[model samples]
Target: MNDQYQALYQTFRWLVPTQFNIAEACCHRWASSSPDARRIAIYYEDESGNREVWTFARLAEAANQLANGLVKMGVGRGDRVGVVLGQRPETVVAHMAIYSVGGVVLPLSAQFGPEALESRLCDSETRVAIVDHASSANLLAVSDNCPALQQIIGIGFADERVLPWRSLLARQPNEFKAVQTRSADPAILLYSSDASGAPKGALLPHSVLIGNLPGFVASQDWFPKPADVFWSPADWASTGGIMGALLPTLYFGHPIVGTRGRFSVERAFELLERYQVTNTFLAPSVVKMMMKAVPEPRHRYQLALRSIMSSGESVGETVFEWCQSALGVTPNEMFGQTEMNYVVGNSNKRWPARPGSMGRPYPGHNVAVLNEDGVPAAAGETGEIAVNRQDAHGYPDPVMFLGYWRNEAATQAKFKGDWCLTGDLASVDGDGYFWHAGRADDVFKSAGHRIGPGEIESCLIGHPAVANAAVVPKPDTERGALVKAYVVLTPEFAHRDRNDILENLQEHVRERLAPYEYPKEIEFVDELPMTTNGKIQRGVLRLREEERAQAPAANTDVGAPLVAPAQQPET
Candidate 1:
């Protein structure tokens, strides 16, 4: 290890107070400390270019009023209150208010359809939902299915059954006392993306925000710089958005920009240039899209971006090199899941980043690659990436989630002894850089050789013709399985001859990666299936391949022939 990183890691200590509350630390404390009530907290702009600025005092006041109103509406401590709004001022207000009232905040994405909303709302037993006009209809449509849902607070519009957000706050006093919640108290209930089955709620305590600080600061290159303005397209409903971007930025008393409406590449650049965003948390998928949309962003836009942290999927060498060359900053890639987040990541300033590798474990987190027997894997050995329940000092890790809400069995299954299994597969090198393998289930045997889709997929993306790709094992009679790839062509190469492009891509992977890892068969697709949070859903593709193997007659294509690409429905 380098002396600089060793010193930082060895000397670091988590100073979690016995009593802590996210609302108090993020909004109320800052509001009360500042002499000026107009200190800006959030700079909000919608897709239409309409803008609004919120001050700390205004945020705290609205939270207090909303807290009082929620109390009056029978919301008590530990109750699940759903905040189904987009990146608007009300979303922030609702989250703070729920936390202030000692209620568990269930942040749901506005992009969710009625079925998706119903499943999560029903699963969490969310009682009162605070929603904006865009999400209210979906929530209301599924309210009948969600028996626990009693009150619906509508932001812009209301009906006879729903209560108006403004009216509810106006009727209550704007001076509610912030709840003194313990550091270990349940604060937020986050649902998993449900790639395997139904989504599970991972209950996070108030100390999670504290646990997230080390990695957050490290990933943002020791954040809270004087002129650091933060922005991210990550949805606040998810861990990457909330813990990675929103909460940590707020805790540091920095102004964060939020925009409403769908995220577009043009809009992202516009916001960065307009707001002078200095730091951002972007998913690898979004980063790839941005890389494709504008290869030379720095030349086109006047950006102040100094640091960027990307997660969700592997950030390949192509994207890594692109960020440094185009953005003038080396993007730090972070790795974590809903249960335990921000545990491992890169800090370019502290330690040099090895592209395509998940950096050493962040300070205060004890992480290792564990074999099936739960023992730490040797250097260059593949295994599940797991985090210890206790830190290196033997103290309980604050970053760990409370447990799965109402599902103890699932929670118990998540751990092997004291290690919390992340279900992700990786291998640690001698230098402590963790290289990603595919998910445990995603890795399969092809001709007596174990192959990970991640390496092959990363190799595929390095090809200029490919915009995004997913590799899966296609069943074969001779070899147990053959490496098959589903590729999404870049806009420039979309209409080209698919047969020639397929051969070129096959050669591209064979030359760069191992010959065994080269996809024996390649299928061009309009788009790969993606989860709502913007992860390429390899499981979906895997299942399709499995089904095709069973019904060979229904799917007779054998070789890397270019048939019409199937259009995948938007998630």
Candidate 2:
């Protein structure tokens, strides 16, 4: 732990009073600070480069109107409101309005299918849903199943039954007195599909917004001030997007640029340059896409990016090298999940990052690598990474989730006394830096040795020819399971001779890892399945492998690519 951050962490609790509301604290307070304040709240743009701007006053007024409108529709405090929208100005307004009226906001991803949408709506017992035209049909399909859902407000289009957003807000007053709520009141419900194999809702309290401040302050690579511009390619529905990009930046009264429509790498670069964005957060996959989309970006655009933060998945060495050369700064890797915001990360401003490590625990967060007996693990010993629910002095980690919504048993299973298990495996070094060893469930046994896919996947991704890689266990009668690799090669290496490439990659892994840890089988694919949050869906891959194993005349190699080794033409 860095001693320098102790003072800041201690002072963070006083920032939010006991009776607090997220909207009143983050929005109304700034808008009403002065009569002539023209502080820009949002700088938005569509796919074609058209721009839209919102001042703090304009934002608060719009949110107030919506809040009042919801009240008129019989929605009030404690009711769950679902927000199914994209990263647009309306999305921000919806979030603020929901909280202003004291309604618990359930953020749904725009990419959710009809079944997924139905499952969450029914589970949360949502009374109202705010959606854009793109997601309107999905919500409508599941409305019948969700008996509690009474109203569906459409952003762009509306039917006889569905209400129009702009028309409804126009009828309501532009002023609303926010409901007073305690810091422990529920604020947001994030649907997370953790190791349990099913979606579970993590209920976050209003204090969570303030709880994240310590991590934000401790994780800054460039130390964002009140005036810096913030933008991110991550979806707002993801925990990192809301905590890292939207909430913290907004709390500081900084202007943020929201992306709309499809995310083109060229447009992203344009936004960074046009907005003169000083700070930004992106998932590692987005960084890789940008690297592929613009090979020599430094020569094409003048980027004023002061710091870059990445999370959602483990970042590899290749991406780090690409960032330093292309963006002129090292991308700070942040680690956390929906259950907890950011607990560990590299803050270059305070402490220099140990390359490829997860960095130290943020101030006020008691993070440690623990063994099976619930004791702290020694340096270089692999164990579960956990955060103490409360410090030795009885200071609770405010950033943690209140509990898994409506699932008391699941919540209880996640903790051991004061330590809350993160379900991730890692090792602490003598210098206090943590190294990721993948999820505990992702670790499989092969030949009496526990193998983590993360270490192997990271090693494969470090190869210059490989664009991405995922490792899974293939059923083996002798070893119980053998390592099988799914690889996506870069464009430059895609058309090369497969035999040579496979041999070279196998040799590469063999040299870096143990003899048995090397992938016994390699299958090249065009792309891998990914979740809404940009994480590779290994669950889907594992299921496919199981189905293939049970197929008629099933080859020992599961889900082998249709294209054979000789099918590749020499390039």
Candidate 3:
């Protein structure tokens, strides 16, 4: 390990619960341990269909080559490099390459189109981009427009002008000088979902994430023994998937299982059994789908699963109970968001599980239920969840991000005196654990995505037939909330076939967005209920969805709009 890494490892020992750098720990484990310990694989049986594996030794070597290749291509300390790859072994290598050089990693979705890719690249002023062979074209399309994108490398396909990954060993220098990076240096940048305006990059230092590991391990039961396999269904584009699962895996030599295709309850179980995954992080909405879509009782196939951890939304009470009873894996639900990061969790280790508690705040961290005025709320009073900034422990050392990349004004506004204001509303009971209330604004969860209802409604209103629109999350077991849009169509849209119109919009959006982001359903109404000022009442629409979903009978209404072949949006 470099001096910088050694210093950090020591710092964590004294200050952080996990006393070692995850990257160094993984490298030493892979090099010195038995060959069996080095065995790791990324299962992709969904689309390509089969078992493909990579040995730890092989991955370590490949990552070394990729790391050197990144350096040779002029990537080094403090530089920003964007990665666009599928959930395969190479994805992990890309992370290693960037970190080894002390460069910051910016992981984007392989599914982002040219336009979305351009937006992120420009905003961060990324220096290098590594894309999957399939997405190289998108990078090339945006590269010229993004002057700061110095080099574009491909993971799978390589040309004479474009370097292929296989040549990293042959063309690049084998000897590399790994930068001894510091705790405060920017190590990762994740762009938040754009709800208010443009997406803002969340810049995080290595120390910020490293500090959360002890609590994470305790809560998720991630350590002591290396889990046989680890997985997180969240996309690499999002920060949760990387920090909450991927980075932690590097702390221990554990193989991870991830699917390159859409998440299926059956496929997830199959992968778990195939890889013998012992610990995992998932969105609870996935839990609902597993029970609904699987053909038979899965407990027989789930012996490999020992821990089921979740976040991005609350662990609905029903799903929490079912997981313990059915899968033999109790749900470890955590609560917090991109701003204040890790606040509370069942700590994954706490048992006799509380009905609604997200567990207590970790040691060194101080949490309080603050009223609208930022003062501590009275006992049993619901208030905005706030993080104490000046506690003797100092934000628990590592459970915080550096700051939002460039939005200094927004940052200052959210912090009131010494507390980091979590816009999330919650309440603390007499016992000290926090209970989640609804969001403070329009942002909500549906189908595992932190969706912006306005974005969906905007697309609906674009159709010539739609004049006004309102969208809301209808709670469902499979996906905590399902997107249900209510639209007031223009007369021209009514003339078109309903089925035809829905089909066209879905196709249009599929072409315009990442696949997981598409809404599951859409509905049309004569007029959206609104206030006197004409602002659509989203709360009222949300209630409408709740009432209909709870009707005392079967809810067979699957209202997906259809489109005629003539006007179907191109994908």
- Please, what is the TM-score per model? 0.80, 0.78, 0.83
Selected candidate, larger TM-score, 1 vs 3? 3
Q: List the residue pairs that clash in candidate 1.
A: none
Off by over 4 Å in 2: 1-16, 442-556, 559-571
Which candidate do you rate higher for lDDT, 1 or 3?
1
**Count of clashing residue pairs in every prediction:** 0, 0, 15
lDDT of every model, 2 decimals: 0.85, 0.78, 0.67
| Overall local distance difference test of candidate 1 | 0.85
lDDT of 1 at 138: 70
**Could you say which candidate leads in lDDT?**
1
243-289, model 2: which lDDT tens digit per residue? 88888888878888888787778888988988989888876667877
> What ordering of candidates by TM-score runs from best to worst?
3, 1, 2
Q: Write the per-residue lDDT of candidate 3 for residues 254-359, one digit (tens) a residue.
A: 6667667766777777777777778888887777777666534463585577777688677777777778777766787776666545557764444334655676
Candidate with the larger TM-score of 1 and 2: 1
Q: Cα lDDT of model 3 overall?
A: 0.67
